[model samples]
Target chain A: MEPVLTALSAGTSVDVLIAALFGSAFGLVFGAIPGLTFTMALALVLPITFALQPTAAIAMLLSTYIGGASGGTVAAILIGVPGTPSSAASVADGHALTRAGKASLTIATATIVSTLGGLFSLVIMLFAVNLLAQVALSFGPAEIFALVIFGMSTICGLAERSMVRGMIGGALGLMAMTIGQDPIDGVPRMTFGSVQLLQGIDLLVAMIGLFAIPQVVETLAGHRAGHQMKIDTSSIKVQLPTLRFLFSYRWNILRSSLLGTIVGAIPGTGGPIAAFLAYSQEKRLAKHPETWGKGDMGGVIAPETANNAVTGGAMIPMLGLGIPGDPATAIILGGFLIHGIQPGPLLFTERPDVIYTVYFLFALSYVLVTILQLLGVRLFVQALRVPHQILALIISVMCVVGSFSIRNSFFDVGAMIVIGFFGYVLQKCRIPLTPILLGLVLGPTMEREFRTAMIMSEGSLSIFSQSPTALVFFGFALLIVAFHVVGSIRSRSAGEARPA
Target chain B: MTTPALRDRWTGLVILLVAIAWIIGSEYVIPSGYSGSAFGPRTFPTGLGILLAILAVVLIAGTFRRRDTLPPPAPSDAVDEPAKVSTRDEMWGAAATFGFLIIYFVAMQVLGFMLATVLLVATFNYFVLGSRSLVTTGAVALGLGVGVWYLMGHLLGVYLPTGMLGLGV
Candidate 1:
């Protein structure tokens, strides 16, 4: 309680509060753009945070995290572009609701429910942080390895249409991870003697390239040609959800929030999966399931709430265990690392002050972001009308600039372009990019843990078997894989039974 | 013949070759130090290579067996789907954009972000966006370029390259 008070005191300071507002505004603007994403936005701001006090820097980044997490819904609702990857599930029903001439209601419901979900998760974070920290304290290298596998196994559940392509994407990312120095030993692998490869591919550059550059090309090719987003703002009305309307979905919101928090607490899963899972569950349970893709208000609420809940859920592992729940959190973890803070069980014990500061700022960021968003909705909606060609050109140049800014290396720009093309080709083939991002983030960790575990066990593979926590995670991973294989076989037979 | 399945097969073949190359490459690389640890750096890459090869094979084989069906028609509800461009036009647009970006990146160091951005934005405005008014194009380019330059370099204090010309603030 004393730590909380201390942190809260610092959090409410003028400088920290000011930083939070600026970060939230930056995140909202970036996240509301179609090609820009939470990860890219955070990465771009990461260098600037270097100059601030630790608490202020983290508070600002956390604000950006909170804002970016929810801001994606704006683009998803208005244009179906999914401003950030987390908002992907929101697009289907969100855009449908907009077309049905309820754009304002959909947006308002999204904003309100998202804030509620975030607060709900923050409550969970307060209650569960200590227990989670205790659990993390028990993990060994083998357990960590199994945890990574469990995280990787999510690719199976996330795979759409084909698990094979998704797995291939994961493999590609893992291969990319092996490009730099081996984590366990400082020995270089796959560098091909290039000095630049010594530090490995910058994940930030790869992320921007993979997410932004392809969108630029795709926008230039497809969207501007005439397939532009035709949003009729003049006829559209923005109406806030009434008390009755908001109260009606109380049970659904609670269920989605709990589900999202649980998924978020897990090592590998984050917002998109949680949003999709929550949305699909609601869709399945709805009385009129046929209304789901057509313009159901429940559809908007479920994904938005779930994704917002993910903000708190993602922070759980980052703060308690030092493992990032998703790519955005991973980048935030990078921010923590840059401040000379190693986040693990030790963090809670050694820096309870910082932990409480995080908690206070994390909750406050939601309030600040919501206010900013309400005041800027008109401005943001106007952003939707900007020409796609201009957006594409700006994004392309920024991608180059942003990539170069990461290390001030031209080589990074080229790497981003190359990865962008690869991402473009894979996206065209319907291969999911999320798994690849997950793999890249977790691959090095997995390798290091596995090697460390083996060394401890004197080269015996049974170290994985011996650890109870590892066995549990491995069991979870196996169950997911089993589910995928069974699901694949069932779908294949169903296809076979169909009329030729 | 123009089915998505055929296209997938080609992609799978390319992946297969890459995976095989990855495997071969993993074996040949000599690390500077020999480790007494049970698992060396090669373990993960070798495993990933095998996984990639297996998946590629499965994908290619599945393509041969699975019946290729056309995608369902676009939903009438879609308001903002991408417009279709001809392959030739798409290539041209891509080349123009990519070409411009590469030049901008190179010039950013020598001419600084401000001047290079001005040049790129002006050129793109004229050629790519096809803006007819030179005055509007130049003004918009100069404004945006200098605005961002001032924001990043002056306000944010991020150091942009001061190239041979040293056109920086």
Candidate 2:
């Protein structure tokens, strides 16, 4: 409570409040753009944050995280482009609302729910991180490995069609991870003697290339080809949810928030899975299931709330255990490393003030986003109308600039282009890129943990059997795999028996 | 659009060939005794390659065994999807983009940064964007080139090559 008060005291200054607001606005625009994501936006701003005081740096990044998380709804509602993977589920309902001329309402609902959810998660982080850290402290390498397997298995659940294709995607990602230096050993495995390969591929460059640049080319190829629907601006006004409305669904919101926070605390799983799960549960239990994907308010609320909750949830493991929950957290970890702050158990004791500062920043960011939604909706909607060609050109230049800026190496740019082409090919083949991103982020950690476990066990395979935490995680992984397999079989069999 | 059957079979064949090649190629190069563990440099890759190969074979077999006939292509109005694109057009665009990148890379090597960026942007704008106003294209191209030169070379202290002219950009 004393730490919270100290952090809150600093937060009261107008300078700090403005900084938070400005940072959130920047994040909102960056996230609303089809190619840009929370991670990219955060990476671009990290160097700039170096010049600021520690509290302000954390504030800026926190604002960016909060804003970027919620900003995806703009693209989702307007263009059916899920800016971040977390917002992917929002498209079905959000875009339908757009088509029905309720874009403004959809955006408003998302904004409100997302803010509420973020606040809920921040509260948990403030009060419950100590308790959560104890649970994470007990996790062994075998348990972490099982968690990784569980994450990879979720790829099957996410695929649009076949589980085989999703598994193939996951395999390809795992293979790509093997291209860098061997994590356990100091010896380089796949560098081929190139000096640049020593550091392996920059995940940021790869992500921008894989996700952003491909979209640039795709947009250029079909410039102004999609339906030109006019955005109705009159509905941009914010309408607060009534107290009755809020209270009636309070349990759903709380349940989804809890679900999201728990999923987020688990390393490797984050927003999209949480959002999809919450949305599905909401629909399954609703009185009118048919309203889902057709502009139901609940449909809009569930995903927005859960996905935003994931931001705070992701920070838990990252701060307490030094394991990133997703790619965005991995990028944020780079910032922590840059600051010479080692995030683990020792961090809590070393920098309680910083932890409270971060908590203050995270909580404040939601307020920043809410203010923007009320005041800047018109400006944002107008920016959305920028021509695809111009957007493509700007994004292509940003990709080139960003890749080169990382190490001031032209070689990185070439790598970016190559990865971009590979991404283009994969996109054409209907492969989801999230699994690949997950694999890259988790690859080194998984390998290091596995090796450590092996060394400790003296080559015994029973290390997993010895630890209770490992056993529980292994059981969870097995259950997830079994559930997915059974579900797929049942679906296929049911399809086979369906009337033509 | 290609039939699902054809797509599956082709994907399987390509994956199988690639996996076998990868396995053989990796064994010859990567060392085996980097660490004392049961796994080595080759273990993960080799195991992954074999798994990928087996998965490919299963997918191909499933493609053959499954007899659920796909419905005929829907009418254009009923589909109401994004505009139907010709594969030929997409390929052409891809090839042109690749060609442009190669030209940009080589030009950067030979002609240096400033001149190359200007020419590349101009060509891309005129050729790719299909802008009719040559004056606007050239002006914007030169403007961006100078901006990048000043920003990256001078402001950021990056040592961009000055080419044969030695203008000290």
Instruction: Give stretches of model 1 more than 4 Å off.
Output: A13-15, A33-40, A43-57, A72-109, A159-161, A234-249, A266-303, A322-325, A338-346, B69-93, B132-136
**Cα RMSD for predicted model 2:** 4.8
* Per-residue alpha-carbon lDDT of candidate 2 for residues A1-500, written as tens digits (9 for 90 to 100): 78778878877676677668767987888777665577767755554454455666577778988888988887787777786778888899888888887776677778888888888888777666776556665667777676556656654443335666666666666667777677667666567787888777876667666666556666666653342334444556555666787777787788778878877776656788899999998889888889888877788788888999988888887777665666677666656655666565556766676677787778778988888965787777676665556555555555665566656577877898898788777777665665566566556666677777887787787987887777776677678667766877788788779865
Q: Fill in the DockQ of model 1.
A: 0.54
For residues A1-500, could you state the per-residue lDDT of candidate 1 as single tens digits? 89878998899998899889988987887788776677766766665565577888898889988888988888898877798878889898899988777888888889989999999999998778878788887788898888778767755354444778878888998899889877767888899899999899887777777666666776777643555666755644457889999999998799889888888877556788899999999999888999898888888889889989988887887788776766688778767776878676778888899888888898889999888787678776676777777767666766776677667788998898888888877887777776777677677778888888888898899988878888998898888778877987888789888875
The candidate 2 chain A region of ten consecutive residues with least summed lDDT is A224-233
Candidate 2 residue runs with Cα over 4 Å from true position: A1-23, A33-62, A74-110, A127-129, A155-161, A224-303, A314-357, B68-80, B83-86, B96-119, B132-169
Instruction: State each model's CA lDDT, in order.
Output: 0.79, 0.71
TM-score of chain A of 2: 0.80
Top candidate when judged by TM-score against the true structure:
1
Judged by DockQ cut-offs, the docking class of candidate 2 is: acceptable
Score chain B of candidate 1 by TM-score: 0.83
